[model samples]
Structures are given as structure tokens and as C-alpha cells.
Target: TPVNHTFGISGGKQFKVGADNNPLSFFIVGSHGTNYSYTGELIRNTTSDGTIYQDQQGDKYSQNINQLVLGNINFGINKAHNLAYNFMMVHANNQYVGQYSGKHTESHQDSNDYTGRAIRQQTNDNLLFTHQLISSWKLSNKMKLNAGASYNRIKGLEPDRRENYLSKQDDGTYILTGSNRQKRFFSELKENDINTKVNLQYKLNDEFDNTNSALEIGYNGRFVDDKFEAVEYNFDALSGTFPIDNLQLDDLYNQANYESGKYTMSVGELNTYNVKKNVHSAYAEATYQLTSPLTANVGLRVDNVDMTVNHRVQHVEPGRESIKKTYFLPSLNLKYDLNDKNAIRMGLSKTYTLPQSKEISPYQYVNIGFASQGNPNLKPSDNYNADLKWDYYLSPSELFTVTGFFKHIVNPIGRVDQGNSAGLLSYSNISAFATVAGIEVELRKNLINRVNTATSKVNRVSLGLNASYIYTDLEVDIVNTPRR
Candidate 1:
């Protein structure tokens, strides 16, 4: 069993008014303080020695504090138009400490028996501001248009601090040196993201006197700019006895020796990079009612993406890379009514997946006895999917559903462990293509409707159950075998 310890407070308010029959609302919400002090036990039954040695048993506790503030304003400009604005900010600080016991003489250079201490602290601050404008117009008795535009700005920063105690001996055997000897690492990152998008949709209905038949055409344009900067520092190993509870980090940095001169600089493992991505897409679909009990929908979409990265390579040379790709996706969906209480649905589609900024960056994360790194040469993945579903309406408040899904994906990404610097984990594209299939069954019921005679429209009790089974086959292309 595990224990949870947390406490927090939150408050919010909303203001609303009606001006000339149009409603306007403004709201603000704020939450501050902490939900922290979580302690846990880790069981490690094995023991190892040497440079790659680590303790298996330990007591770990973590503390987290955060604050959130959000504000929104929305109003109807007219019956067919609306405008809204939202702003949110969050700040968090997290700290963790762990204690482990082991044979000190076998690992540390010193002869004294000591318990290992590991401390980690990090802080993150984020801000997001967005504005959206939407409009709806009835062009004709059977036609409608919906359009919207949004602009967003995001900014964030992360500062991480890690420290450990270890000893180095002239004979090349290192051991747990306790708190008297310390090794510290610090990393700071800043990021800014700006995005703008515009979307327009038009619908036409009642074609050929069939009220259920419709056609829809949509176009979307987006522009994105993201910038990142990171700096890392390593403090020279210090020898002394001091209380860690009241240790001032700023004073320590100023008094302690630095491995890279007096000031921290970006070099080698601390290299920095920047990446930018832009996408434009458009789609069109048509829905036709072939019969009173059946309907069909077909659609096509096109997407164009451009990605650029700028960074320094291993030889300290400026390097630039760019990728431009386009995709044409098509989809079809069909629905048929077997009876008043039963229906079946089938769908087929093509999809694309892109990598995130962190996944494509060449940054590295370091920890005791382990480290994880990123890959910059990752490519996008494409997937083809098909799904069939059947739904049965047992009653007004109850239903049963069964679904089967299949997918064929190309270029799946996975992690690999590298025995460098003792051990390191990295991400890469592992398979050329993969196939996946799954089946799911779901049932939902309103207990109030089946157990008690109630006149109220709302159901006081409800139950839902679902289960699924999946199968996958992947073709290995990069490594010898999959890690997991």
C-alpha cells in the first residue's frame, strides 16, 4: 500500500450581464499553494559495486508546490458572431530527496560507512494567452457558413538542480563519500511559442429535395513559431561538512569551483538548438442519404508541413536541417439502421503523425546511474485505419456496443539503451511498418430506471463496463529487437 498527503485551496468568480438582448460574461479563477510531502519506499534486492554501482533499497519523499491563474471574457457581438479571450498562467516547484544504504567501503574511496543521499529540485513557469473570434452566417435557407480565427502566445522556463555525494580514489575505485563530498549539476531552459490559425467551413443541404443530404467544405491555415534556449552547468566537486537544509544555492555557486571557467557556458553535452514548424491544410466532404435507413459520407484532406532545425554538431560546427512533406488523406464512413433499436457503423481513414519538439531535439537528461537522450533525425509516421461498430439500444437509458478496429502504421518510434558513459537511453525510429488489431465491448445502463420507479427525468444511478483485447505485429528495421 502507498500513502498520499496533499492539501490545496482554490477560488473563482464569474460576471455576466445582458446588453441590448445580447449576453456578455467575464470570469477569473485562481489557485495557489501546494499539495505536497509524498513519501514512498523503494525495494531493491540486488547490490553492485564499481563506477556503475547503485544502492537498491531507499526511502524517497517529494514535495510539490504550484499556482494557477486563469481569466476569460466572452460576449456575443451579434446573433451570428461571437468573440472570446482567455489567459492562463502556471508556476510550479518540485523537490525530492532519497536515502539509500549500502556497503560504503566497497563503492566510496573513504573507509567510513555512510548512507547515500540524492537530492533533486526543479521549477517551471508557464504562461498562455489566446484570443478567438467566431462567426456563423445563414447564407441561404439550405446553406450555412461557420468561420473562426485564433491567436495564441505561450512562454515557459524550467530550471533543474541535481546533486549527489560520491568519492574518487587514486586507485580508480569510487565509493559513497556521503554529504561531505558533493557533485552538482544545473540546467536552465527558456521557450517561447506563437501560433495563429484561421478556419472556414461552409455547408450546403437539401440537395435534390433530400433534406438529409449535405455537402461541407473547409479550409484551414496555420503559422507557428517556437524558440528554445538551454544552458547547463557543472559545479566542481567540493569537500566539506555542511547542513543541506539551509544551504543557499546562489552562495554555493559563487563560492564553489566551476568546471567550465568562472561563468557557465554551452558546450559539448550542453549544446543548444532551435526548431520551427508550419502546417497548412484543407478538406472537403459530402454526405448523401441513399435511403431512409442508410447514409454515406466521403471526404478528402490535404496537408503541407515544413520543419526547420538549427544547431551545433559534435565538431562545434553550425548545422542546419529542414524537412518539407505533404500528405493526401481520404476517409469514408457508412451508417445503416438494422431496425428501430439497432445500428451499424463502418469507417476507413488515412492519418499522419508528427514528432514533438523534445522528441526531435538532441538534448540529454542525466541522473544517477542512468541517462536519457533525444534524436534529431526522426521522421513523421503514416497510418491507415479501419473500424466497424455495432450498437444495440436495449432501452431508453441502456445500450450495448461492440467494435473492431485495425491499423497499419509506418515508422514507429521506440527507445533503445546505449552502454555509453556506463548506460544511456535514446529514442529512434525502430520499425518500418506495423499492424495492429483490437476488439472492444461496452455496456451502459441506468440503474435507477431498472431498479426503482422514478418520475424524475434524471437518473440517480448509472453503470458502465468495457473491455478490449489487442494484437500487434511490427517489422524491425533499425535495431536487433524491440526494447519492450
Candidate 2:
């Protein structure tokens, strides 16, 4: 005999706005939410062992929104010829429901019965636009130059649904010996992205000379298009009764009846799947300073990945693929000032990550009591990191610091089990390795001052404290592995 249950929640939000005078500004925001839940279990049997019942229930709801218009404008005439604008919109929704039931009894016959139910829903939406421009120039002796450009647009949407059921029974009037199942699912997705960027800076001496140094370069790009759709449905049923009581089984089942004869039947199935993805990227970076504690950084990148798959079952086959990659990264930093309160710092870096589009997309789904499959030959993971730091300042607000780190990781991905007991799963890429070491600590002080209450002067008292911790160790060598 055991039982447990819980529920508690409340929510609110609201706003309104209107104001204009050329350099625009407008706003509106809203929100709402809810929750509910219940649980149960009961068993009774005195002296003869047998009587049990159980129950469960759940519910949820949500809502949201945001809208905005912002501004600043002046075409040209000096003051750096300015212009800026922004517009935005967003929305959200969520829902959930659940249920369960059970029963059992002995001596008076009826041994067991069970039932279950579930439902879920979700929604999301977004829209945005932005623009900007600024310029300035002056070149002579202590030269100067500044430039800028920006533009962006984005849109998104998502949808989801789920439903499930289960049943079982045996004995005393609740006749239906046992076996029932049901499933339903639906999904939708859409996305779009576009971006642009530009910037430049240069300065040559003007009493601002640590032996003169200032120059930078930048470039950015992005393009993404995505779409997906899914659907599924299933049902099962079984019936039983034989021997112990057969009253000639209704005249031997209508004398072995046949009018379109097709006996012993059970069948129900429906399925669908679709997928698409496209992504592109471009990046560039450069920064330089060859004095005042030396520094330099460099970067270059390029990428393209594409995929497509469709299925409705019939030996099931439809596929498309594309991949292209290029990357070169360089980094360096050094600082030395062993005076006026000590200092030393050093750094190095290189990084890359890519592989998750449902782990390469080959699509297969049926959840909870399992059947999930996806793996289109996945690959792409790399990292290299180095660090050293030491700083100390005893007075002028007191401080002390220390840091050391090292990392190396490559091609690691996992999920495996494919012998099935009516549950199947697969996804693989592993040649694993891991190592990590960490330390961080901080402390601050200022406790109490100003306390005189009889009518304000108690100027908000103070006390402060902080703490941190991290530790990791992992080693794997393939042979039925699971650790996270």
C-alpha cells in the first residue's frame, strides 16, 4: 500500500503603450500560465489477501507575447551621419495532460485491471528585422577612421503533439482477459536566417603612443533554411475466453460459420516521416598589437552541410547529402608586468564542433517502450586548449588568483543497444578520451555600517559571500559502456 500526489502554481502579466515624435518608440508585453495535478493508490484485504486500486492525473497550460518598435535617425549632414532601426515580435504556447488507473481483487475473483493515458502540445513563433549605419573620417598626422554596416532578418515556427494509452484486465465481470495499446503523434517545423556585417578601425599616434599601434578587421556571414514534418498512428486489440466454461461455446460458434470467412484477426498501423536541412557559414577575424605586452590573433572559417530524407515504408528509401569544411585558427596572448602589484598571463586555442541534425538523420521513431533510430554516419568534433594565469594585489580592495587548464578531445558520440526485447536503438561514433582539472575561489568583505531607525537613515545594510567547485575524470575503452 503506497500513495503520493502534488500540485501548486499561479501566474500573471500585462502591459500597454503608445507614444511618438518621429524618433520612434512603441511597446507591448503579455504573459499567462497555469498548472494542476492529482495522484492516488488504495488497497484493502483483511484476512484473505486481495483488493487493490490505483490512480494518477496531471494538467498544464501556458501563454506568452512581446512586441516592439525602436528608433534613431538622421540621414547626413555631420555628427557622423547616423541611422538605426529595430522591429520585433514573438509568441509561445504549451499544454499537457495525463492519467492512469488500476484494480485487483482475489477470492471474490477479479484479479487485475489497468489503464493509462497521456497528451502533450506545444507552439512557438518569432519575427525580427534590423538595420544600422554610421561613418566618420579624418586623416592627417594623428590620423583617424571609423566605419560600420549591419542588417538582419529572421523567422521561426514549431509545432508538436502526442497521445498514448494502455489497458489490461482479468476476472469477475471485468471480462477481457488482457491486451490493448494506442499511439498518436504529429510535428511541424520551419526556420529562416540571413545576416551581414562590416567594420574597420585605424589610429596612428596622438599622444596615445606606446610606440603607436591600432588596426582591426572583421567580416561575418550566415544563411540557414530548414523544414520538417512528421505523423504516426497505431492501435492494437486482443480478446480471450476458452475451456473452463464453454456452454458448447454458443452452438460451436454458429456451426463453424463462414459467410466471408476470415478468422483470428488483429491489425492497425499508420506511419510517415520527412526531413530537410541546409546550412552555410563564413567568418574572418584579425587583430594586432606588437607592443605594450605583445598580442596577436587570426581566424578563418568556411562550412556547408546539407541533408534530406523521406519515408512512408515500402523497403523505405530516399536520401541526399552534402558536406564541405575548412578552418584555420591562430591565437596568442602574453602579458608581463612584474611590478606595481605583480602579473603574468598566457593563452593558446583551436576549436571545432558539428554533428547533430538528429545525429545525422536517417529517421525512425516510436517512443516509451522503445524504438528510436537515427545515424547517417556522423562525424566532426575537435578541440585543443591551453592556459596559464597568476595575479596578486594585496591592498586596494584585496585580491589573489591562480589558473591552469589543458584539454584535447576528438570524435566522440554514443548511443547503442540493438538486440531488442521489443525495444531497439542505435547511433555510434566513439574512440573516447577525457581529462579535466579545475580550481577557482573568491572572497569579498564589507559588513555593517549605518544603523539608526526611527524614521529612515538605515541605508540598506550589507554582507557578502561566494563559493565555487568543479571536478572531472573520465576514461573509456569500449565494451558495453555507460557513464555521464
lDDT of each prediction vs. the true structure? Answer: 0.64, 0.45
Give the alpha carbon lDDT tens digit for every residue of 1-484 in model 2. Answer: 2222223233323222234222322233333333232323232322112233223343344344434444444333233323333333333333333332243222233334443332234445555555555444544333445454545444444433333333333342222222323333555545455554443545434332543344545454444454455555433322343333322322322324322341232333333334444444454444445555544444454445454544343223655544445555555556665676767767777666665555555566544223466666666666666777676665445556666766665665655544333233556555564545565554443344455677656554344444545555555433343433
| TM-scores, all models, native as reference | 0.76, 0.26
Candidate 2 overall lDDT versus native: 0.45
Tens-digit lDDT track of model 1 for 270-384 = 4666778788888888888777778899999999889887775332356666768999999999999999899999999999887776667666665544456767788888999
Please report the TM-score between candidate 2 and the true structure.
0.26
Q: What is the lDDT of residue 383 in candidate 2?
A: 64
- In candidate 1, residue 451 scores what lDDT? 35
Q: Locate the minimum summed-lDDT window of 10 residues in model 1.
A: 43-52
